[model samples]
Target: MRRLKAESIFTPKGNSVNEKMYVPRSELETAFIKALRKPKHIIVHGESGCGKTWLYKKILAERKIKYEVLNAATVNTAGSISNAIRALTARLTPFETKSYEERKGATASVGVAKGDLQHTRKYDALPLEPYLELIRILYRNAGANDSFLVIENLEHIVKDEKLVRELSSILMYLDDSEYAKYKIRIILVGTTSNLRDYFSKIDSSQTIINRTQEIPEVSVLLSADAKALVKRGFFDLLKAKCLVDPAKGFDEGYLLNAISWFSANVPQYIHELCLELALEIEANNYIITNELYTQCLRNWVQEALVSENTRMEAHLNSKATKHARRNQVIFTIGLISSNEFSAQEVEDSLRNRFPDSTYGKTLNIPAILNELASGNSPLIRKTPKGTRFRFLDPKIKIMARWILVKDEGKDTITVKKFDESIKF
Candidate 1:
């Protein structure tokens, strides 16, 4: 290479990397489309960087459909529903009001701003029925075939029980309203915890739960898919431009071995791991040999450790809080170490340790487990039940045991070994 271009190498550039990136399985999109075409409601949960949002966007773009997208982060209060309604209504229908007509009629309608005819309380207030009517009128004006409303990151609503209850009730009401009969569908995308936590609080959610389609279980990428991911990122993107050529030749077999150790067969990680490799090559000019990968991984872990330590220090420095976060820190580390505990088991351990603590009080311990599990560090994995908790990397697990021995701590049993020794 003549010279490394940081902009071209580090940041994805040219010809749209999206074309090269692996598309997530279509089962989720198929189900979502089916739900939209029919009366089905939907909830999709995906980990950070899982491309769930991207997939949703693709479906919206490719399908012959009309839809509205709302970022749940923006919905802070009941009043904010106005914006959600406007977005949804605009998608359902486009409007063209004559300025001259509005000017002529402006004096007759006092208090209503000349350009803000839709700002009436009738549409803004709670039952949300009038808003649906506005959507219908706009749909007619726009000549949209139908309307679909997508709410992203619903964890915001789920965090507040009252808000979740209100949203749930609104959805249920809309489902049956004549206004929604053929022209409307609602899709909710949020963390799994948000769904379960809100539903667990209110008995009425059972109806909503039954009506909605669940995200199809994301399976580990087959060996072929994994290889494709690597080939696209390294051979096609990097090697084509001689950006970060591997010494071992960026072969499919090497990529397969590297990703097989990941917790989930998440397709998105392929992009991230490639990014890490690019950064490493730029910083150290290390050829992408197998040994170089090992070194890169070590550096990645150390960086994660330093970041975690900094976060812990910040929490400790924030002394205004009533609760001491030391227990949480210890619990997080222990949970990471004892990778064998189920969500329930982890909660039970925490409860036993601190009877007064209320962090894990909910039956939705699985959600808590998930939050703990997906770390930037590779020191966690999901159990069979899809609960997240800490577990050491294979090498780190061994080192932990050795440290326990050096410190004279009690019982450094390896759960995998212990399980194997038990009789069936």
Candidate 2:
């Protein structure tokens, strides 16, 4: 009799995993290896959840190097930069005997001047000169032959021209500093929007940008990679089955069938979804079937829809007052709803719906275009002519359709009419 196959494996939750179950991007590995050999500043820019952080961590671990990581999402603001610097300084200070003695003296000296070291811990902001001095002192005290400053989510602070200039100066200073002759490195991580915006505004920032290494483009998984992912999931389920019972049930046929239907070679999405289906199958007694896997897919789609709704709600609330034009609203909605149109097509679509609206203005179009392309929208992506937009997320597309049908009753307004309102 053919044995009953157990379901898929458990998907790892909340960004915790060492071994990557997804297809490894060879370009990423190559870039990482080069950076490891020579301490070089790097910028790993990509869409969110495209494995930026994971790739960074993996490469660092594989090389067995000492480094520090500062998550910009947790602390990135005008004042947070000082805190980030201090936090990084604290970590870079090693625990060796010499470092301890050096830090002890530096602490004592500051304490003597300020009355107490504790009072200095809370700061509004550290002046640029003093901040640089502190970094130099810390490096000396720690006896670090080489050091690396890993800054993530730099866009959070890069928006301010002054701040961007200062950051540029700081990186340049450190890169050229006599102490860095031993090969200190700086690694900046952010989405592509961050880099684009930063570069457009700050001339000095180009100095820093030129020195950084970039991760290569990621393509869809190969046939071998897809098979490997399927195999990993199947084997995980088998291990689980052994623990539950010296299983008489659970066979390769059932596992292969499930893989064929739901697996798309998107590792991050596939690994987790497979694991979820596996758990349900185990609970129902190792009888994995296509129907149960289908249920899991349905659940995944629903979850994705809910997440997209939350994003759209936040986006709408923030920009409703700022971007009130009907055409602009339609453009944004189209951006989230479909990824197939060119800029001309979007303009055509808007013109058809609102022919009188001043949809021809370049300035207004670019602003909306920037917002969508900046990774802030998470749903819309820009093509070449700034007129085209694609929905990056499928769930956002579904939500956009719902919104369009619901708002069909409103008086249709065109770009020309919108321009008329602005006329004083």
Candidate 3:
């Protein structure tokens, strides 16, 4: 009997945790819960928009654990971090106890020099012992279940040695405790999957990584999970919204395959595409059709993917190079699932996708790749050593899928409407 609006059940950009729509990443949740219970500092890393923030927030809330999240991007500077810590654990108390007699009468002012009577403000510049205060406050704040300081977006400062060192210094201090048992811990969340490598590049990197425990990368959801989200939201929740049996003029069997393919296994993109499709049902007599889905894809591209599409168009073949098949070759590259690929792999993909097209046989793939990566409004970039390349953004491939289609009749590729690309 559970029910909700499409927008409420599906959120792409919103920060609110939709428990009704949440599909628990079981393995990830289990590992994270284990990490939380352990004594070591924790690091959770994955590609951007892979649900890192929501997962931890959901787990912490369920366990009723006390925690605070500070975005590293906002507190990029070391001084800002120190200021935040200072507010929590550092204080200055007056130590002036010296007795002084006030000039009550002319007798007290008997000094020959009147200037001598004015007593300048004085205090013993006492020792800081900031670490001691930090420990005291941290332990006090660490209630029955202890406390967690989750630093989200750790990737923002990993490149700066000073910030990383300042941060590691605190981590080292936490380990120096002798007798007292303090439960306060730190959890670092980031978008980069290679977080440890980023730290290892720094001098004395072991000092920080040694104190942290990193579970498996929270990469894109498994194909099954992605489909579950679609089924739960599109088929169940949308039905509850009084739009049961919404599929129209389309073979509903393919809906799951369509979403999983177009979403590229990214949960957020899946949510976004599903939300748009659900809206079509609400607006069009509670009936969703292939044409509606197709139009929704274009609307999504125009709204959020304008930049990627523009970049793609900028990297296309010129008018005089029409027969060169640049667009067709790039679409074949988009068919590649791996983010990092070499020119040879791309050429092979070209042959596989377009066996009839002679362009694959003669195209100078490496040179074309270099130009695409280095040209104006570059579509991709090469690694520092130039061994491999990847799309400048993952969204680029998604945009290409929606915008370009291969014309089997002519063995050519052209920008076309979504209906043309729909296999059904």
Clashes of each: 3, 15, 0
Q: Go through the candidates in order and give each one's C-alpha lDDT.
A: 0.50, 0.51, 0.70
Kindly provide the TM-score of model 1 when superposed on the true structure, using C-alpha atoms. 0.56
**Of the candidates numbered 1 and 2, which has the greater TM-score value?**
2
Better of 1 and 2 by lDDT: 2
- Worst 10-residue lDDT window for candidate 1 reads 415-424
Which candidate has the top score in lDDT? Answer: 3
Task: Give one digit per residue, the lDDT tens place, for model 2 in 1-424.
Answer: 2333432133333354446354477877797778656545667765444466677777776655545666666454436565667655556654422311112223445436643333223233433443464456545644664555577766565566665665666566545666465455667776543363465467765666666655563323444565566666555524433222225332554444334333333345555566666667667565555556557655654564556655555444223333345335543454332234554555555545544444564435445544655655555665423456655643454444333322343424222211111110
How do the residues 117-212 of candidate 3 rate in per-residue lDDT, one tens digit apiece? 344444554544544445455556556357777888887777676777767766666466641355667788986555666666668678777778
Model 3 error, position 367 (Å): 6.0
**Candidate 2 positional error at 243, Å:** 20
Ranking by lDDT: 3, 2, 1
Please identify model 1 stretches exceeding 4 Å from their true place.
1-17, 24-26, 77-134, 137-142, 193-197, 218-224, 240-252, 259-264, 279-287, 290-424
RMSD of each: 12.0, 12.6, 6.5
Better of 1 and 3 by lDDT: 3
Q: What is the TM-score of each predicted model, taking all chains together?
A: 0.56, 0.58, 0.74
